[model samples]
Target: MSIWEEHPLARRFWKEGRADFPIYDMHGHMGSLNTIHLARAEADQMVAHMRRIGVKHLVFSHHHALFEPSFRNVRAWEICRNHPDILRMYVAINPHYPDHIREDLALFDSWKPFAVGLKLLPDYHQVPLNDRRYEYALRFAAERKLPVLSHTWGGSSCNGYPQLAEVIHKYPGLIFFIAHALFGDWEGAERLVRESAGNVYLELTALPGERGLLERLTASVGSERLLYGTDLPWFDEYQVVGGVLSADITEQDMRNIFYANVERLLGRDW
Candidate 1:
C-alpha cells in the first residue's frame, strides 16, 4: 500500500470532514470579484469551510483590498477582528499609491496581531516586485521581520523569480512567502529555496494540484521551508488538504507544512 493508504490522518480526513491535523492556511483571499464567481467568498462562509476541513487558522487578503484602490484594508481588518480565532490578514499594498501604502504602514501596528503581514500582487498592480514604490513596504517589513506574501509566477516580469531574488537579497530580514511557488518553473522554485539563507518560504496555494511537486519540494528544502496554503474561496479546502495528506513525505513534514512552520513564523500566540 502507498504511505497515505495506511495513514491515520488520511483515513480520518476521508471519514470525517476533518482530521486530527491542524492546518494553517498561509495564503487566501476573501470577498467576491468582478471577473469570477466565488461561492464561499464571505468571511463567515470561509471560516465555516476552514472549520470543516480542520484548518486552525487562515491568513488572507480581501479581493477588494487588492483590486479597489479606494477600498484600502479597513474592511479586512474588521473581518479579521470579527473572526480572530480563525482569521488573520495581510495589509494589501498597491505600489501605484505610495501615499496609501504609507498611510497603511503608519497604521499597521494599530492592527496588532490581526494584521499579520503584507500582501503584494505585482502582476495585477502593474509593477515589478522590487520596484522603488514597494521599497517602503519592504523596508518596513524587513525592519520588523514581518511575513510578506507576494503573488509569484515563473516568467512574468512583475513578480517572477528574478524580481523575487533581488528583493530576497535586498531584504534578508523579511520572511518572504512566494505564493504559487513560481507557478510553472519548478526548477527555479527549488533553486530559490536551496539558495536562500532561510528567510524564504514556498507557499502552496495553487501548487497542490501538481502531483509530486510537494514531495519534490519537501525533499529539496525539507518541510520547514514549505508552507501550506490554499487560495480559499478560489480553491477547494478538502482538495488541497487531501493533496498534502496523500504526499509521499512523512507525517512530520506534513505537520510542518500544515501548521508547525507557520506557528513558528507567526508564533504560538498568533
Candidate 2:
C-alpha cells in the first residue's frame, strides 16, 4: 500500500472532502473565457464549489479583466464585493493601457481588503513583465509589500524566467507568486525558488496533474515557499486536493500548502 492509503487526513479527504483542512486558494479565475468554456465560472457557483471542497478563501482575477481591452477589473470588483466572506481579488494590470494601470492603482486602496494584490498576464498582454509599462504597478506593489501574481511560463518572452528574474530582484519587497511555477521547466522553477530570498512563491494551479512534481518541489524548497491554487473554474478542486493529499509529504506540509503559508503571507490583510 502507498503512504497516503493509511493517512487519516488523506482518508478523510477522500471520503468527505477537506472539512478539517481549510484551503486558501491563492490563484484562481472568475468569469467565462472567450477561447474555452468553464462550467462554474460565476462567483456564486465558485463559492458553492469552494464550500463543497472546504476552501475557506480564494483570491482570483476575472477572465475578462485579464483578456478584454475595455472591461479591465470592474466585474472583479463587483463579484468580490458580493462574496466578501470567501473571495478576494487581484487588480488586473494590462501594460498596454498605462492610463488604466494608473487609474486602477489610484483607486486600489478604496477597494480595501477586497483587493488583495495585482495580477499580471504578461504573455497574454504581449508585454514582458520587466518592461517600463509595468513599472508603476510593480513599484506600487513593492512599496506596499503587496502580493503580485504573474502568469509565468518556461520560455515565453513575456513573463518567462528571464523577465521574472529581473523584476523579482528589482522589487524584492513585492510578495511574488509565480503562477503555474514556470509551467514546463521544472528545473528552472526549482532554481528560481532556491535563488530567491523568500519573497518568491510557487503557486500550484495546474501542477498537481504531474505525479511527483509536488513532492519534488517540497523537497527542494520546503512547503512554506509553496502556495495552493486551484485555477478555479479551469480545474477541479478535488483533483488538486487529491494530488496534494496523495503526495508523500507530511500533514503539516499539506496544511502549509493549503492554508498556513497563505495566511502568513496575507497576515491581517485577509
lDDT score of model 1?
Answer: 0.89
lDDT of each: 0.89, 0.87
Estimated TM-score for each candidate: 0.96, 0.96
The weakest ten consecutive residues by lDDT in model 1 span 1-10
lDDT of 2 at 270: 75
Candidate 1: TM-score? 0.96
lDDT of 2 by residue, 56-172 (tens): 789898888888879867668878889888899999999999999898889899887889899999999899999999999999999999999999998989988889999988988
On lDDT, the candidate that comes out on top is 1
Candidate 2: Cα lDDT at 222: 90
Error of model 1, residue 62, in angstroms = 0.6
- Deviation of model 1 at 201, angstroms: 0.3
